[model samples]
Structure formats: C-alpha cells, structure tokens
Target: ASRCAKVRSSDVAVLELERPGSNARHRISEEIARAISEDKAEAIVLGCAGMADLAHSLSEEHGVPVLDGVVCAVTLAESLFKVGLKTSKIGGYAAPRGKRFAGMFAPLSPAG
Candidate 1:
C-alpha cells in the first residue's frame, strides 16, 4: 500500500515474500522478525486489527511485547475508568460558558 502511494524511504520495510491475502500467524511473525531486525526495534506492534488475536503468541515467540492498538485502547480505557480518572459533568464535561453564534449554526450557541 505504501509503495502504491509512492512512499520511498529507508524508514519503511516491506515483506514481499509473504503470500498475498494471507495474514496467518507464521507470516505475520516472519514479518515482525524482519522489521525488528532491520529497524533495530525494541518491540513489535501489530499493524492490522485482524492481528489482535495473535498479539500474545507473537510476543512470546519474539521475546518482546507485541502490541495491538485496539487492545491497548480498551485496556487504557478500562484502567482509567477503574481509577476514576474520567470526565465528570461537574468539571471538564460541564456545558460551555455563555457564547454567541451567528448564521446557520446560530442555534448551537451555548446560551441556547
């Protein structure tokens, strides 16, 4: 995809040997190893949402933390909620202070 977008940089690496349309664990793991070694990375972050299920196994295989963005988001939300670190109606979530509006969106003024 990046290639098709004309992205040319040493910072990017692509695994061209993997079978097309296949995101199997082994194939992903192979690519992860390549990226880690080629980029001298400390960890692997699964790039696709479909790879979320393989995060644990891949992490174990590579001896590094494999991160899935979806899982990270959910985990962060849960942790914050558990710690009562969320928006509150009495504070940040409170309605905006009085303000005027004009034109088509005039009715959306805080005064309204």
Candidate 2:
C-alpha cells in the first residue's frame, strides 16, 4: 500500500482466499464480487494464474475491469518484445542458482 501510494493514492483492501485449486473459480468470483461490494473497488485484480481464463468473463459480468497478473505479464512482455525492449541484465536479472532436489521433487533438479 505504501509503495503504490508513492505513485498513486488509493485504498488497498486485502482479500483472502479460503479455497484452493482451479475448481474454486465460482467461489473466487463470489469473493471478488463481495470485495467489490464491501470496498466499492473500481476493478478486480486476480492474484492467481488459475483465474486468468475467467478475467474477461468476470469483467463483463461484474461491469468492471478484471485483471489477471499472468495475462497482464504475458501481454506486457509480448508488447515490449514487439517494440524491441529487452530486459536489463542487472540486479535481479542474474541466472538462477541451481540446487539439488530430493524425494518426489528429484525430477525437478538442475541435473535433469
């Protein structure tokens, strides 16, 4: 809230997710609607990748912009790439420090 307030002033209301998995779309939508009603928020910001596909539909159903982080990221990256804007190789851009894995996560090791 403080970080965003530095650039733009707004009310930040944190909504919690009670359920999990892709099957929680309707429940999530209900929660979003509830939040909007309670907070009088102008838009819905989806916090999960699984909610990407529901963005447009939810936006239309709720009469407001429903933004999904995954979709926004992909769209922004594609737009940037099209305009020849590449990511800067500084600070957080460094290559991942690989590590070993065990048990059921062994297949996800860097060696693989």
Candidate 3:
C-alpha cells in the first residue's frame, strides 16, 4: 500500500497477487514480467517485505528496477529517530508483543 502511495499517479501501475504466502518469487516475477511485456513498466517495486528479500532475484529475472519498501522504510525511520523523533503514545498503536487476539487467525506470529 505504501508503494502505491509513494508512486506518482501518472507514472506507474500497481498490481497485487492474491496469496503472497504461497509463491513469493514466481508470483511477483510473473506479474512484473507481464507488466514489462504489456504495460511497458520500467521498474517493479516489490509490494511485500518477503518480496523485498527476493528483490534482487526478481530484478535480475525481469531485467527491471526492483525496490524493497523495508529498505526504504528503515532508512527513513532511522533518519527520523536520529533526528529526535518519537511515536504517538495515545493511539491504539502499540507493540505487538503485549497484544491479545480474538480472530479467525488468533495469536498470529512470524515463521522463521
């Protein structure tokens, strides 16, 4: 979503796959290839952090520029924090470590 937000409206098209968990490399690469072949996209920005890890391979496979939001976000965040910044403390936003869950996929956690 941030990728979509970062891009200029007149410049690029954003396409998302249904299940990013299943085929990280192939799905993004195929979509990018299609975009390159059809829409004449000059670059493909990876939409997921997982896809970010695959950014290099995807760029090579598609022969186009590939970007990872993680890298860019981290750089921006670090710069902000370094310049004396702090996050809001009044909102619903908080650390995930102390959160409780009541959902279809309860207590979700990352897989190593």
Top TM-score model? 1
What CA RMSD would candidate 2 show?
Answer: 11.0
Error of 1 at 110 (Å): 6.7
Model 3 lDDT, full chain set: 0.63
- Stretches of model 1 off by over 4 angstroms after superposition: 1-23, 88-95, 100-112
lDDT of 1 by residue, 56-97 (tens): 988988888888988898999999989989677777689778
Worst 10 residues of 3 by lDDT: 5-14
Q: What C-alpha lDDT values do all the predictions have?
A: 0.67, 0.68, 0.63
Alpha carbon lDDT at 63, candidate 1: 87
Lowest lDDT block of 10, candidate 2: 3-12
Candidate 2 collision pairs: none
Q: Answer with 1 or 3, whichever has the higher lDDT.
A: 1
Better of 1 and 3 by TM-score: 1
